[model samples]
Target: MAHFLSESELSKIESEKGKESVKRAVKSKTADVDNEMRDIREQRARLVEERKKKRPQTTDKRTIAEIHKEKREVQDEIRRIQDSISCDAKIVLPEHEST
Candidate 1:
């Protein structure tokens, strides 16, 4: 049975479809960002461990400075990716929506 839809209904349907596409795109992008963040975090952890192993007692100024700088860089990267993920957080659509 063919039931005609009003203009408003058709418009709403189109809008919903557009939103769905946008949501899917956002989800995929978020996943990628999340993976990047995870990698960065792992790198940071490794850096920390390396630093610890190098100096179990005395802090070498040059080595400490270099490790600190690297830590800051990794932290910055994590923060940037976190912000990117949160920026699109409003559109992280659920698996399904009930009409």
Candidate 2:
């Protein structure tokens, strides 16, 4: 004969399963964030390299300004990603709360 779980036991198993699901979701999100951060850093490095090269004779103030703007935008994006990661780290799951 198969054993049936009581209500409390079933709820406990469900809660544990939910917690595992949440943990997997969090890990997946974190991995995605890491990949994004890596890509942004690579882009930032490329921008720096580009800035170091000599500009062509036809290069104008507008072009130079645009490059600078792009660099600033990349920097801002890095900071935002970092802040988001830190904020995410601080989150407390409801199921993790102590009674």
Candidate 3:
């Protein structure tokens, strides 16, 4: 037999579903950001070590190019994280109708 729910009940169910979806999305996004931040921090630490080995070397164009490449990679990572969070927020899980 088919049953009907009142408007308030329907709305409440929808609100709950939406809240849960948002919570999951936020958690996923937070995890991704934390992982990426850790990776970037590790890379920066390595860069620092490279800088500290003050083996007075000539200014090489390749070093300059590598630095720029690293900078761009970091920027891209940040942008990807932001996009992931935003995309996650836009997702709406299909609501299951109550029996």
Candidate 4:
């Protein structure tokens, strides 16, 4: 098969393909991170609820300090992931095309 593509054209096409792959990879990673954050939030909410349901007259499932500590850890984890991953689709275009 004969192909008609200049070297520069081929380079551009290859770069475009690479960008597409990068976008997909970033999207997948972002989703995974977002899901992890959501799970952490849900876990923290459950902990808060469980801690609040203790009756003064009965044995509690967990002490207040323990619940607070776990909640804080979860919050920290969420912040860590949020800083490392962008939930938004941050597609990075080639510099020449960015303008």
Candidate 5:
């Protein structure tokens, strides 16, 4: 005879699978956002260092604006990353919820 899962066991298995799927999707999105944020931050840092070395008094408004924009974009990217991967790591099975 073939083994079969009881109704409760089947429901638990389905719930676990759904949670795993959500976790994987979140991780993939977070990774992409993190990489983009890192690149933008590095570029902004380079621009700041270059400005410090070359221009002591002369201030270019456009360059400053560009750097600010980059900083904003990086901040936005980090927030997006946080939103995507903010799920609870500790998963409690539904069957044990009543206890």
Candidate 6:
């Protein structure tokens, strides 16, 4: 003979399932945030390396100015990436939507 669950028992079971689903979603979001952070770090490292390699050895005014401009641009990009990392670090799971 098959046993039937009471209303309260069914509700408890559903609540547990919902909790598990939320946990899984949170875990997945965390992984995505970590990946984004890694990518941003890699991008910042690459920009720094490129800036180092582009260092000028000349005393020419125009060349120095161009190098400085490029350096400023790279610095700005790095700053933006840092800001993005900071934002991602503060990520929170969204609330469940009612169907």
Largest TM-score belongs to which candidate? 6
Model 4, position 28, has a per-residue lDDT of 65
State candidate 2's TM-score: 0.38
Q: Write the per-residue lDDT of candidate 6 for residues 2-93, one digit (tens) a residue.
A: 23445675566558778677566556656777787888899999999999899876588998899999999999999999998877756643
For residues 33-90, write the lDDT of model 3, one tens digit per residue. Answer: 7787888899999999988896576778999999999999999999999998877656
Higher-scoring candidate on TM-score, 3 or 5: 3
Off by over 4 Å in 5: 1-18, 56-99
Candidate 2 deviant stretches above 4 angstroms: 1-17, 55-99
Clashing pairs in 4: none
Candidate 4 residue spans exceeding 4 A from truth: 1-17, 55-99
Q: How does each model score on lDDT?
A: 0.75, 0.74, 0.74, 0.70, 0.71, 0.74
Clashes of 6: 0
lDDT of 4 by residue, 3-80 (tens): 344568556655777867656655665677778788889999999988888735654567867888999999999998
Clashing pairs in 2: none
Model 3, which residues run further than 4 Å from truth?
1-17, 57-99
- After TM-score superposition, the amount by which residue 57's alpha carbon in candidate 2 deviates from its true location, in angstroms, is 12
**Candidate 6, residue 88: lDDT:** 71
Could you estimate the TM-score for every candidate? 0.39, 0.38, 0.37, 0.39, 0.35, 0.41
The TM-score measured for candidate 6 stands at 0.41
Better of 1 and 3 by TM-score: 1
